[model samples]
Target: MDWQAHARTLAAQIVRPESRWFEPLATTPRHTLVPRWWDSVDGQWALQDGARDPGRWLDVVYSDRTLVTRVGPVHADAAAPGTVVDGLPTSSSTLPGLVVQMFQHAVIDDDTSQVLVTTGSGYGTALACQRLGEQRVTSIDIDPNLVATARERMNLLRLRPDMKVCDVTGKLPGAYDRIVSTVSVRPVPASWLALLRPGGRLFTTIAGTGLIVTADKTEDGGAVGRVTPDPAGFMRTRQADDYDNPTREVWEKAQHADGDSVSVSRYPLLYVPDSWAVMSMLALDVPGIDHRVHEDGDQRTVWMLHPDGSWARATSGGFLEGPTVHQGGPRRLWDALERIRNRLNREGQLPVYGARVTIAPDGETTLSRGGWTVTL
Candidate 1:
């Protein structure tokens, strides 16, 4: 089976009918960029030896699922064929569908345009280079090894983009007509606005949420746009491991909460990933909302928690009993959710994708919709 054929099919699945990325996605050789990857199995990430499974490799490689190409600081190139390291997925060539959607948002012009995209496994960089020539693209990544490997991969295809080992969270390499980030960001880095020329567009995913923002650079050093209705999960920009091993006390409480303080809930089950509007609204309003989804046998569980000491759990249980909720911090978790829901009830809809963003030069962000404004 030709991996190129598979890549074409994968691209079709991701590119929208009205998107211009279709032609590029269909022609680019994505498998060459992601020669080997790590796959999740048994709740653990294991190395998937592409060379060993050459026959089945293309199937996994082109699938919409994320393939981890680096662990912690270790690139998959250094590891042996069967080596498996479990730290955290540090880098990857994001799923094809997501890449296409992001590019679609970018709205790249075919008339002598330059775009800056974060170089991960170089798959996205390859796509951009394929769409817009190598000279028209500048790809940067924080990890030097990733840049080096990506350069090699691009060289193999004879498609050389300006691959640089620079941190996108800081200064960008050069001015660009469009900037698209695969990595999620807590705040739209001021450097992005500085890099973009006037009338330029910046497309990126909001860190810690599934919100996709497409903003245009304004003359006053700010950008604004309505959130994309499509939901996505980008690896959060990390200085290091972005997780903490739960303390014994916290673990115990999560496993066994006190009664009355946490009563069983009665709410319809909703996956945050599947609810772009509600999730985006919550992200803007609540700010720091962490979520975890657990699946046991036939049951699915979702836990939503905010930094302000509010938590909600919606199990597979019926809505009559409500959700197992706990709130004691400054901001009430369930109350906040209920408030958003009540607004939706009264207004007949929630403003999430429609939320307007005003990114200031000082890096302050304000999200407003229907007269309600949240600043972060």
Candidate 2:
């Protein structure tokens, strides 16, 4: 396969030729790091091995797409042929465009050294190694198998980063000038602050939202920056072997079942997840609510459920039309969503996207813009 040519084409689309990331993205063999991956088909994971069909493999690896490397606790490389599983994705080789985009937000420079980055499929770390040199990169993952597998695969590309098994939210391996994570995190981890040099920076997305946060470390062991214009989402940082899904009870309680109060919405039915601004704001104002959608022909229903037994169900004749909303539990979730949507309609925008972020040493984050402020 003419991998170099394809890589160049991909790099052109992902990054400008003059950008430092261009050469790295164009040269790194992503296929080497992700030999096999999972694809969701009919609500189950179907494994695809690159070795079996080199042609399709090259196309997939070279394209701007994410490859799921692990689902539940199953790594695609170790899964047997004809393997199918029902589980949420645990890890993936992030799409190349977003990888470079997140790195660009970190603004890694020649003076920056000893960078700490997440090691998922090792593709991102490989790009870092290609750009900053392996000696300056320290990559980590909580899963030992992922750490070992990523280390070996990267070695095939003649790149060997210092990969380790460590939860990014806990004590880190070493101090560094820059840290970038492809995984989404709730509170910006305090360990990142403890290890970051005073003048260094870190970039990551908040879990359950598409907000990309970039902050520069302060002299007093804190950091302050803004939510960049770009948006992204990744798997939450898992401390254990796999991710825990939203409970079935939340779904059962919310899905199709009527609620304590029912009424028609003032506005059109909007799936909160599809709108980054709405979702980010909703997540900030009311945390821990799981959003789900059910569709049948022209009719669709959206569910919002929280661990505390709060739930909102909205059914629409069509996705774009006003919905008949039902709310129950400790709080009215659909009401909160309606307020956010109302604010969007009234003010024309939400502050969640471009809000300035201030992080304390303990990882408590405060976001403020205009007169709106929220903390996580």
Candidate 3:
């Protein structure tokens, strides 16, 4: 397979003809960065080796989709074939289109601007290098192994950028004209504001939701901006070996408990993650609801679990029918979801998108729109 040709074709499909990113996307060898990755199969993460299946590898690599390179602490390169690990994706090469879109959001127009971006597969870093010279680009990741491997892969392509292993939430390596994070965070890190030059811009999504915030540094050690109309979701930044796994006891209970309250849902069963606006609002309001869905023939079960011992389970016979909900613990998880859905139905759109975003020096974030305000 002609991987270069395929990449060019993908670039044409994803980027506009007049975009500066067109050439970068067309030339970058994504296959080299993700020669081995994890693919979900039968509810298990199976290792996919590119060298073993060149055709399948070329197709996935050139396509505009995310490839999981690490699950928990297990890098796909070290996993044996037929190996299956059931865990969350810890690292990945983000979709090419999204990466380009984020770069566009960062407004990297000047060749002199020093840009700092999160390094996952190093694919985005490579693109940045192609657009703005390698001297002006710096990529950082929390995992040392990922940073080293990314540097090695970029070296193979003869595209070198400063790659460092450091927690992005902490002090940055250097001052930059722009900081674009593909990873999400709860509160906007104060270090980011400190590292930015006076007019420096930052782009990132809120953790666990599809809220993309584009802000510029202020003189008062704060930043002010509005959420983008387009939605984006990224994995949360982690300083440890891996993210904390949800408690097994809570999941087991939520799976088979009658709960403290039971009633028929007024609205049909809905998955929060399916709708960008709805999910963003819920994440801002409730903060940390873990969502799961199980389907058996015509029966569907949806669950929302919070770390605070709150869980809600909704079950329905068919797609159009309302679900019978069971809730337990302190917060009524299902009711909260329903209220958001009700607002969506009445207002025709959630007020989250394009809302005013303000981040104080102390890391307090407030989103205000139409008299509704949420502080994070």
Candidate 4:
């Protein structure tokens, strides 16, 4: 099937030599983990079950991209061949490149520091098992079926990493020298700190935003690290079957609701996902600013909202000039976005990745820079 050739090409394009994950990216057999996967078609994500067409399956399996394994709560394997699941992606094995990037920051060593990684499609677990012996690794996922499938796949490769179905946002299972999460978290869980031995390290992505934090546990029961230069996004941990579906409601409110909530914007059309520095600043200053983007034939819309009754809607009409922005509520959404842009423009700075993180003994994380502090 020329699987090695396909993997080699995809790896070359995504994995850099400077990355610590070069070996895993080059050696792990990604084609085996995702033989068939769903593809986006006509604005909906569809699936091609592995047992179907070997040719089409191999191409998808080796491609350096994400594949949706579950829609809502239904696993792709349970669906018929060529079936389309028009629901939000509830589970996925992240692309090999991004997985490697997360692992690159993990900084696994030859020492016998037990490693813990979140299991989704089991691909990341396989890579960890490959780097450190399977015995030294433990991988967990909230979905029982996913953990079961991942365990089977690891066994297929004759590896034996401990597998469990557990929510990483809550209490972790055991003590570890290193903890790395593929799933994102809103706040660095205090349970995670308790799970780490003194001097242990953690590499993880922030939930609801594109930020990666790598911190080391201190003797005083706290941690500290700076944001990474790269932008990485992962599925936020879900306590329920599905997220509350707030986007539609928010959009409808914006279209219908009106009030005399005057506000002066802080910033411009700063696409949070595109700009790491601004994204970091927003996340640091105002934690939990949810963003979503939808694109049509010629129009693109980016919506920004916060739990604090703040909302901003920006739309690009037909690929023309500046976007039309409508912002309302107690806090001016556009103003905040513009404020961030202005700070970057005037002071030639944005405090995000470079901002210092201080995890207090009480589990409060505060980002501070230039006499400004944001409690997260």
| RMSD to the hidden true structure, all candidates | 3.1, 1.3, 1.1, 3.1
Compute each candidate's TM-score over C-alphas: 0.86, 0.97, 0.98, 0.87
For candidate 1, the per-residue lDDT at 142 reads 82
Q: Where does candidate 4 have its weakest 10-residue lDDT segment?
A: 259-268
Q: What tens-digit string does per-residue lDDT give for candidate 4 at 10-120?
A: 667786765545666666777677665667898787877655676666677777788888778767777776687676777787988787777767778678469999988
**Hey, what RMSD does candidate 2 come out at?**
1.3
Deviation of model 1 at 139, angstroms: 0.7
- lDDT for 132 in candidate 2 is 90
Distance from true location, Cα of 144 in model 1, Å: 1.5
Q: Write the per-residue lDDT of candidate 2 for residues 1-376, one digit (tens) a residue.
A: 6788889999999878998889998999888888899999977899999989999899999999999989999999899998999888999999999988888889986667889999999999998899899999999998999999999888788888788888888898788989999888989999999999988999999998989999999988999999988778888888777776555677787776778999999788888999998998898888777887878899888889888889999989975678999898889999999899889999998888888999998899999999999899
Which candidate leads the pack in TM-score?
Answer: 3
Which segments of candidate 4 are over 4 A away from where they belong?
9-23, 256-271, 293-300, 306-309, 316-320
lDDT of 4 at 358: 74
Superior candidate under TM-score, 3 versus 4? 3
lDDT against the true structure, per candidate, is 0.74, 0.89, 0.90, 0.75
| lDDT (Cα, 0-100) at 243 in candidate 1 | 39
Q: Give per-residue CA lDDT, model 1, range 1-376, as digits (tens).
A: 4767787787678766455677777777777888888777766667777778787887888788778888776677777766667666779888877776687788876774889999999988888888788899999888777899889978998998888887778877789889999898878898898888898999888876777888888889888776776678787676543334333233344443542355453345666656766776777677666666787765666766655455555566443445555544355555666676677778887776667878887667777778777776
Candidate 3 residues lying further than 4 Å off, grouped into runs, are: none
List runs of model 1 lying over 4 Å from the truth: 11-23, 71-74, 80-88, 241-249, 264-266, 269-274, 295-301, 305-320, 327-331
